[model samples]
Target: MLFLLILFLGGPAVLTSGRVWPLYGTPRKTVTLSSYGGHVFQEEGVWNYSTMLLREDMDVLILGARETIFALDLNNITNKKAMVKWEVIPDTQEICSLKGKTKETECQNYIRILHKMSDGRMYVCGTNAFNPTCDYMSYTHGNLSLESKHLEGKGKCPFDPFQRSTSEFVDGELYSATTLNFLGSEPVMMRSLNDSIRTEFSRSWLSEPSFIGMKHVAEGQKNPEGDDDKIYLFFSEAGLEYDSYKKMDVSRVARVCKGDLGGQRTLQKKWTSFLKARLDCPVSQTKLPFLIQDVFLYCPGDWSTCVFYGVFTPQTDMLQYSAVCTYRIQDIRDVFSKSKFKAMDSSSSRWVTYNGDVPEPRPGACINNNARQKKFFKSLDLPDKTLQFVKDKLLMDQAVEPSSKEPLLVKKGAAFTSIVVASTTALDGSIHQVMFIGTASGSVLKAVNYDEETVITEEVQLFAHSVPVKILRLSTTMGQLYAGSDVAAVQMPLSSCDHYTSCMDCVLARDPFCGWDLISNSCVAINSIQPDTHSEVVQSLRDGKASRCPAVESSTTIKFFYPGNMVSLLCEPGSNLAQVQWHVNGHPVENSNVYQIQHNTLLILKASDSDTGHYNCTSVETIKGVDYMTQSATYELRLGDFMTDPSVQPLVQEHQNTLLALKVLVIILTLMLLALVAWNFYKGYFAIPKCFNSDEESQQKTSGCQKPLQTGGRNSAASKACSSNSNNNHNRLSGNQHNGDQVF
Candidate 1:
């Protein structure tokens, strides 16, 4: 059966009548670059990977541990750093006078949050004096304000600015989350704008058991009528049922008005409420718990409509994995209007619960003002009376029709440890929502929904795979990503000029920032191209220049010369073969070889005027089939007198013909003489030449011509003997002797 099939298939192939044979195909070229290996980094610091701010104005600012902030250029110029506009704030322990602050030496008291206010001032907040103090500084010129109320005396800061604080500026108000002290944190959300400031604690507003962290993602984001700005906060804690059980159900996204902040306090309505809802999380097991570690606001162009993205994970010690949950801001506002969980005259609202096997406590339980509760209450400066009227107007059972449409629920089951969302305008003028995440295993993952069908994920393992990512933040410009933990800070350029393929390859190649120094074995940038710096071969691409390549020429002939020799090659204007290589016969010359390849490949080599030959160049190309080998114009090298050797000349004409005829005449005469002598010798007689005077006995042989042995003798031995005897006599007498004797 196999033989029959083979014959059937071979019929047309054997005939060679059809065109399609073996199916046309080209090799798939997939680029592969390594992501593993190690090399020394030029910058010194640990866990400083998260970026707090990214601006495209050629200036990128990043906040790291130990108060290390780096202002770098769009192009990575970290090395050969002439001057780093930087300053390292001392650790909280060394600078803060708090008793145990010095004992806890590992505490990173550097700046945790950075935001530019409406006044063009950059506000930096530290965890405490031990954590550093909250201070406002002019971003353009380094003008720092009095270190708030936190940095005073032997050191008693009202708040720990570095302690997981989230700050946002809205309508001239700076809202932030801060722990009151280092000992037992009195976590609270504070608002400051001009002269007025106020604080709302866990006891009065959120009414939660405790607090975790807060993230304010809405920057200058507001409601349509522009009456009030909505700032979203995500908070997490242990559930009421499972006291020690760290559950994500305890995590809640809430909205508050910016105008209500830093105003006259009221019993029940100290802060104007907007909305709150439990994140729809996916988790298992009551013992293994979850919490909202961080929150990020993402507004992909449609400012009025935005997605609230949060990082939900287990309590630090109990966390099994990480997850990312997304909810719409409109849904959260629904929670505040409900009668089931409303603050009526200072009385806490009823707590609701769910029976799902998900994160323990159901949504609706309030957040007790931790880091997660600090919102950019830059809410549109609305009248308190209007907010009160809206709250009063909202009926308990009546559903509030959200101004914005429901958020498209995407990526419900996956987890992440940290998330930061930013809006960016693509090169095409379209806006996109980007979420940056740091995984438990120290993997930095970026998630973006380019379409309704797909979510893109690109991740890089930042740590040694063991150190879980503690924090991650992407600069607003989205140009840098920073990841930090207990160890090191890693900063990478988010947008670089190099191709993405080349970037991956460069990473895989493990080329260190150390500039390549020919004197030493190191990988360096070719830009540092000083003679002594390094020997690098830079590839200059000339799109469709010239072809001086011998490889493109006919295989039959090739000529080679040192560089600087003048030789030329011709090529069509639109040839696919863009490059030309000059070969001597068959061998290719090394790049450094004296032969120079030019733009036109007029193969301009500096010739000593002596170099000339049938120089061959080939224009090589890989096309659909049959690789093309194009030959250049054939050149006949004509050298000047000094270049040509006179000793090497073509042969003379007369001597050539004379030699041919003289040789023919000699052969004919010899043969004739032999015939005569043989005839006589065969008849038992001897013969002598006319010129030879021989005895009568010897000479008498000439008369006896007895049939000459029939010329062509029947006996082979007789014939040979006759031929030999005749041949010897011819040699004895010559034409010269006959001619001379005749004359005498």
Candidate 2:
């Protein structure tokens, strides 16, 4: 009876007035798939794959678990498809193996970075198993294994993956990001792609061990005629502190011409170099107090032109806050030619921080490079066109702020580990850059800017519970976006779910891990609560030792029907220690005449049309230590059903009115007929009796009848007289009949 009552009241159709359909159920299975590279992976350790990149032919480079590296193929995997195709421990295993190292079956060797070199070979870098090393391998199409001629060099491989380095192919030379430490130290702005080539021009202004960070700024950019002969390298020094950010310090942007990648071994003027001033960011500097972890350059459009974007944060805040910053490819290059360096005295140089550095023309610095050009100035690089250094700010805010127009804070923050940008065309036919930010909190937030501004036009939260996002990347084919945190690697198709309009913080506050789009509105998965129809044994026998649930007693999550939608509830399952009360905002969901409980579930039948708010499923549990109360996943309840568009609601009302009018008319007609019958019966019993024939008239009537029978002449005359009297009596009766008739 209890179950029946709950079902009757809280069924999706009943509660919602037949609006929304419930779409979530108990998760069938949560498998922590193998990490890219690991020794002994715990069942829960599948969340560790954080760094990712796409190789040629849809192969993915995944970095995780100490020195482990796995290349996976993501062509055929989804919630519905339960299969994975991957190649484990690429051919660099020989270089990763350490001699005399105590091996404990634990995955010790892990691949940190994978970079494709100029010679069509792959350079794989390990942070360090026993000792950090770079392994070089040549890749062949359709083959999974690395075809290496030999392990020619140990640690001298010129390609470094972790440092902020950019590479390009110029003439016959390759340039890359190189640094002092295995991870990073003093930075080498740019270098030849191959370790064997040592050119004179390569060692001059661009020569420095990569300690800070470096990347290719104008790679693949072509002149108007479309010749891609030249490339630009953006380099910065490391260990430099920011105005108010982190301990680590770095410059904004510098350039090394590929024309300088290969030259003579020794020369006064080796690699041609140009230095650009640092960008000015205002809002993020005050909020985020950390330094940048990395930078990535994106070529978002068909034109060879590019934009340099980086991830930044503050150093002090315990909870890391970060931002993403963007600059145009032309702005940095123009800075060098725009400003002239004033000579500094020896004593003045020691006192002045950037004494030798040049300044912009005038009104030089704007958050975005919107400063106007001066009427006249001298530029050594472009003498004809006066040099003017200007800054162009694209986006701001650690995550995309829905309202702010500043550039993203391209610095590291608490709970944040990695950032990557995916460039794609939106439904509007316009190009957009989707940024995936991984936080230390173990959650991933995807942000994209629309309206030609930096504010996050849309933000969606991924992951059920908070888990740090360690690394993220987009596929070359623009097919999918992959994210890696500490424990699991998640794959999201380019257009999988609806674009989330609300920010993650807003979703978290309401505890509605699920949302329905108000526009092309549909119920979407914000948590791991999926749509499963397998009808688990637990759904029947509530406490009969059925299959174990997928969630822990304190944080288990389930999806149930409420009104017009599937409400995902994160709560403790099966434990009935105390009153299990459901609340919206802070109001309790009480059991009254319409409230019901079933299988440890609460259902509200005839859910009020106005009860839309955040619903919380709260349960109090007392263990050995103390009493504790926990709330399930927050559900943001929006009124009405996506299935029942409001445009048709009025038609139903009109149909109902027509039926009511017909019923009222039938009742009125029946009452009138009953009254007429009662009146006729009263007249027959009272008024008609009063008009009964008198004794004389009765006698005359009888006599008339008898006279007609008499045969004699005397009786015939008497019969004639009686007939006249009888005729009078008959006339009176006919007259009375007219008066007594009742009209209906």
Highest lDDT among the candidates is held by which one? 1
lDDT of 1 at 168: 61
The sequence of per-residue lDDT tens digits that candidate 2 reaches over residues 1-744 is 233224334321111112121111111111121221111222233324543446644354433334344555555323211112122253333343344333432224434545665566566544343344445544344333444333322222222322333344344444544443333333443443353332222221233433233454433344442222233433333322121232232334444444332222222122323333434332321432234455666776643466666665544445334656666655554554344332223554311133233333221221111221332211122211112211111111112111223444332323445566776532222455666665665444445544432322222344435565556666756466676655555665543323322222122111122333323234343332233512221111111121222222323222223463333333443232234657767777665755555544655555555555666665544322333343344555555553453434566777789899989999999999888888888788534332135665455444345434446698878767767877898899898887778531
For residues 45-136, could you state the per-residue lDDT of candidate 1 as single tens digits?
53343435443443544343444444444334242212122232454445554454443433454456566665655555544445445565
- Listed in order, each prediction's TM-score against the native is 0.47, 0.46
**What lDDT does the true structure give each of the candidates?**
0.42, 0.40
Model 1: which ten-residue window has the lowest total lDDT? 23-32
In order of listing, the candidates' clash counts read 56, 84
The alpha-carbon lDDT assigned to residue 532 of candidate 2 equals 50
